[model samples]
Target chain A: MRIGFIGFGEVGYEMSKGFLTEDPQAQFFVYDPLYEKEETQQRAKKTHATLFSDPQSVAKETLDVLFVAVPAPFAEDAWRSIWSELNEETLHVDLTTASAQVKQRLGEDMLNEKRTFIDGAIMGALKVYQHKVPIMVSGTGSTSLIDWGKSTHMNLTYAGDLPGDATNIKFIRSIFTKGLSALLHEVMQAADKLALDDIILDSITRTMDKEPFEQIINRLISSNVIHSQRREKEMENVIDFLNSHGIEPQMTKATRDKLKMITQANILEKNQGDPPKDWKQVMRLVNCT
Target chain B: MRIGFIGFGEVGYEMSKGFLTEDPQAQFFVYDPLYEKEETQQRAKKTHATLFSDPQSVAKETLDVLFVAVPAPFAEDAWRSIWSELNEETLHVDLTTASAQVKQRLGEDMLNEKRTFIDGAIMGALKVYQHKVPIMVSGTGSTSLIDWGKSTHMNLTYAGDLPGDATNIKFIRSIFTKGLSALLHEVMQAADKLALDDIILDSITRTMDKEPFEQIINRLISSNVIHSQRREKEMENVIDFLNSHGIEPQMTKATRDKLKMITQANILEKNQGDPPKDWKQVMRLVNCT
Candidate 1:
């Protein structure tokens, strides 16, 4: 089956690789501005994938599926504007963390064009990309596509046969995962400021007592070190949720503000790199003093 | 051992009953303006336990342990002024859900007066009172008092030997427990407006996909009906924390705003009863339509 993918960044690259792993003979069409990045372009060539020159060219080439794996705060208006430029109405799958409202809106337009729209929000990290990452896909035309996804080794779960179902589910669950990670970062730092580090750790363990807040906290810190930039924006959304709840987000507020402050201070080894040691050391040691 | 409890309210009343059930003969010098309605007071009269006239009397009279089950949003000036009247440096234990800062400030002042201040926070519903509810206590005075508590039938867990430890621990856990409850309430209402209740529920359960958010959402909705007013205030704090993270909280913000609307509608029987519904219905149904 010939499949074409657009915007081969973090998620898209992995997805195209997954299809290749399933069937080496699977002819693939991929396009990414980053294909020029060191070894990426070579890997695309080695996998026997054709990198398309433009969206129109990619659309002209008849393909089994057109996967859209792009960054969220998605290009909705831009997508709609450019969407008309494409000539074909093929099965289009979106594997982005988009809002349910956006999916619902896009679903309507895609259906009118006689194409299939599947909201497949990948719930795994980039590491599990081509391997066995579980993707929750929900839409009017979802079940039909899941069969094809299975043949291509995509771990897909049908949340329900509705357009916005999977995205809504992903956002809800994300409230705990990403939101809590951001919260933990703040609280750990608060513990440091108040000089109550040991007690805070004890509380985290107790919070994790018969739960998993401890392990979750560690991963959040690691993720912040890696995706510190995205985390900053994500945490802003989290604080808005926290306020609406009337719960005191003791640490999360500090973490987000501190990130802003660091950025304002113009301290960047890389765009989204972790904060310096002074900040990192804030709650690393849980001492009485 | 004889103990005196000032503030015979929901938490106080229930905790005393647990003490009574554990040791029928345990003496309690109880004091409260609403001493008339206290089941503990009535039961104490039936069991012939001693009663004190006032807060001052409890301290002056023969009382081994002093349990201050005061309502929180504790006034710093008022608490300090009244606490100063104690004169005697007795075994003072506070089991109020006061702010961590309040606990720290008060703990320091009490310590200066050579008083053993144990920071204690109740860890379960007030209904459970004594039976299953665990008490988390921590402070410089915790070791000695926790020993006394163990000798007598107090359900206590020493969080750490530090001032303000217990409240910090409780509030942090509340960040998840009560915070999520409010978040759940908001989105459930939003789902109602969208007419996708089943979709949201299925998505959350699937996305939450076998984690504490499932059990946490279950417990918050099923049992612990936090006062909406308190929930509102608590959500504010969580929101402040989320703002620090730079993440946009969809459900949490929706939940928070809806809760404000719930507060506005005056759903609480007297405008201050348990939240609009038991958390279970809140999680499964309440605004879920």
Candidate 2:
């Protein structure tokens, strides 16, 4: 099987190496602006692959699979440049962090052109997971790639038939992971100032470990109405404290606003003293407010 | 030792119940507005404890320990109302989510009045951990509480000698826990909308279980400089996508801003292609920017 890679950057390079490890005899074509670098040249030589100067040339090959692992900002341009070179049989997989809407547009365009396009959103650190990294794919033509991926021991899931379903899942997941990491960073600063980062981290780990994610969400949402007022008041003080400390407190402010909004919505009024049974109900209440 | 609880609220009730379980002969005096409630009255009778109508009465009992478990906003007021009633030897322990400033002010006031004040910040769900829940304490009066807490099988940590140190630790910790919960709730809504909550939660658990929290933090901070641009672009799209779905995108927007700020700082410029050796260094770079 011949595989072509467009951008030989961090994730793309790691994935290419994984392919070589799985099947050393796999034919390969690569194109990267840094192809002339000693590292890139040596990698290509070891894999018995040809290094093309242009993305178009790499796509010109009638490969079994072509992975487009470019940066998200350049994903659309790269797709358009490779459009003329892809054959109807080539399975084009994109691993960029593009939004679902962007992925959907590309998926529609490729389908109209009688080609297969798979929106493969990779999750986790590429360096750590390597070939075992999880990828969520969604498109009309993702079934074949999913099968191929599983056969090679790749952690791949077929999200849905919608072009951007996989991307949507990835972005939504980011709202938790990246958002948490950013908040943690800000928190670490404040904790460090107090010289209590270790103790605070210990507390965080304890809370996270002691409860299942589902239970935590249910508990927090169900008690939202009962505690919103207290939380809002406390969070206001928190926001002011953080601001005085020279931090912007974006997340803190948002948390305070969300709590206040939930209180204003009066979700408790609907239940007459009982809390919402599900997080979805709470969310609906939030949106309504 | 005679123990008095001034709030007799959710957390106060849990802690008192735990204390009773640990020492069946223990005596308690509780003061709460809901003391007339059948549940509170029954609990007091079951524990063979006294009930008081006012915080002042609870403080006036000449008890060895007095626990002030009021809401954060009222924490200061509760302390002031009880100050005149407390004897010189009474150990005052406050378990509220009050700001560090508020805690410090109360601590100083109590100390000036010739009483020991321990700024104790309880961590975790009172309903879950009960008396075994972790508490971080600060101020000069914390050492005795730590010894007492350990003897009674309560999880306690002496954060530092600073009056507001414990509250500082708690608020910083709250930034991460509350921020993550809010982000998770938003993600859950989006996932529920797509009927992918199960799959996404599975993926989240897998990733979390695959790596230790420390390792995850290190890896993110270390490779941050290299991937900041990609992450910033991806997060920007995430913010837009979340907004399009009617989610307020507070956490998402904060995540995007943090990423952009880090990239703009260009920490890599100082390292000259080398990643930071520790998270503290990364944070320093972020603060510098």
Candidate 3:
């Protein structure tokens, strides 16, 4: 097997190392502007991958797969530099954390009858999962990569046939995960003000770990829709308490605003004072309003 | 034992029913403005408790415990209506969802060597747990109520000797749980726009359910501190994606602002470019800035 990497940064280095573990005889080629950097050289030596000064040479190698692992902003430049030199049979996978629109545009521009362009989104922490990090791919070429992934021991999931479906899922997922991190940061700030950091952490941990994620999400959304008025009052009290302790409650303020919005929307009355069975119903009702 | 309630609302009704199951012979007294309502009357008769139109009568019953379960705005009125008539031996448990400052003020005003004032905060859904709802109490009288709670099969935790400690804990916890609900609502809005509600929920559920709560929190906080710049960029992409889908991205916008704040604070440089070992360190660093 032969493989090529357009950018031998952390991702390319880690993935190359992971690939070598599964296929020891597989030949590797890499192109990176920082190829002369000691760290980059060390990574290339460790993976025993040949390094090149430009992307065109790597693309011309007629490899089975060519991964574009540059930063999001530079992804197009990398693609533009290599596409013209790539063989028809080589799978071109773009793994940058670009927006779905950008990925879709790139996939559309690169579309051809014989050439395969896979829009790939790394879904887990590469530092922890390395090459086996869960990767979701969408586009015309995703299925072929999934079939080939069987021997490479890569964790790959086909999201959809659309070029940007994988990136769309990832971006939507970030709204929850990143929003959660921001909320945690604000909570910790309040906990510090109260000198109750340990206690607060323990309390929330118990609450979150007590139920399955689906159950917790359902209960929160349903209860939120049903009791928005009551929760709005509770949040006012929380905001007041945090303010009294000299802490600025940014995220808490947003939470209060959200609860107030729900109450003002009259969702409880719309639902006849019954809590929704799941979050999807809550979304539908709220969105309809 | 004689137990009196200053309010015969949902909380008082459920708790009285729960108490009877444990101590069938326990005497119960109640007082609320809504005592004549059919629902209140039904609950009172079902629990075999006598209802009084005035709080003074319930207070004069020489009860072992007197629970003030009125709404926050009326908590002071209920307390004033009954305190002067209460026997010195009765424990006064304030279960209103009042502000901690209000609870502390009440506790201070009621403080005396002979009388016991307990600031009680219900920590779970009364509708679900009913009488067994987890309750946290703080004040001079909390330990005594905890002792009595043993025979009643109630879930109770002692917070501190300070009057508002339980309320403070509950309020701080709201910052996290309520913030989470708001985040989920926004995410669902975006998911609805993308028509990826099920996929997004499944993705987040998998991420959340894959780890223990403490570990998840630690990872989020630490990684957030370390990679704020990268995450800020990712959030920008998310905002663009959500906006393109016609969703407002309110919570996602706040999340981006928070990440920008962290990056602007130079947390990565301040932390020597390493992720904090735990959330506490992240809190300390962010707070220092």
Q: Which candidate is the best by DockQ?
A: 3
Clash count of each predicted structure: 45, 0, 0
Model 2, A60-79: lDDT tens digits are: 88888898888778888989
lDDT tens digits by residue: candidate 1, B1-289: 6676676666656666677777887776766656666564685575455665556666666667777776665434424534744544356777776665677888788767877777887776667556337778877678787777776666788777665677766654544433333233333333433444555555554444355443443333332233445455545544543444333344344445544544454434442455434322332222222
lDDT of 2 by residue, B1-289 (tens): 5899888878777887888888887789889778889988887777677998887888878687789887778888888887778877777888887778888888787777777888888876788888899888888678988887777899988888777888888778777766666667667777766667776777766667675667766666666567877887777777777678766677677777877766777788876767889777777766664
Q: Judged by DockQ relative to the true structure, which candidate is superior, 1 or 2?
A: 2
Question: Against the true two-chain complex, what DockQ does each candidate achieve?
Answer: 0.06, 0.43, 0.68
Docking class of 3: medium
Q: Sorted by TM-score, highest first, which candidate order results?
A: 3, 2, 1
Instruction: Provide the lDDT at B276 for model 3.
Output: 75
Comparing 2 and 3 on lDDT, the stronger one: 3
* Model number 3 iRMSD: 1.3
Model 1 lDDT tens row, A9-42 = 7675666677667787887777654656756577
Interface RMSD of 2: 2.3
Against the true structure, what is each candidate's TM-score? 0.60, 0.78, 0.88
Off by over 4 Å in 1: A6-12, A30-44, A52-62, A68-90, A95-115, A171-176, A195-289, B7-12, B33-47, B54-63, B70-91, B96-115, B131-133, B187-289
Give all candidates' CA lDDT scores.
0.57, 0.78, 0.84
Distance from true location, Cα of B170 in model 2, Å: 2.3
Q: State fnat for each of the candidate structures.
A: 0.07, 0.48, 0.72
DockQ, prediction 1: 0.06
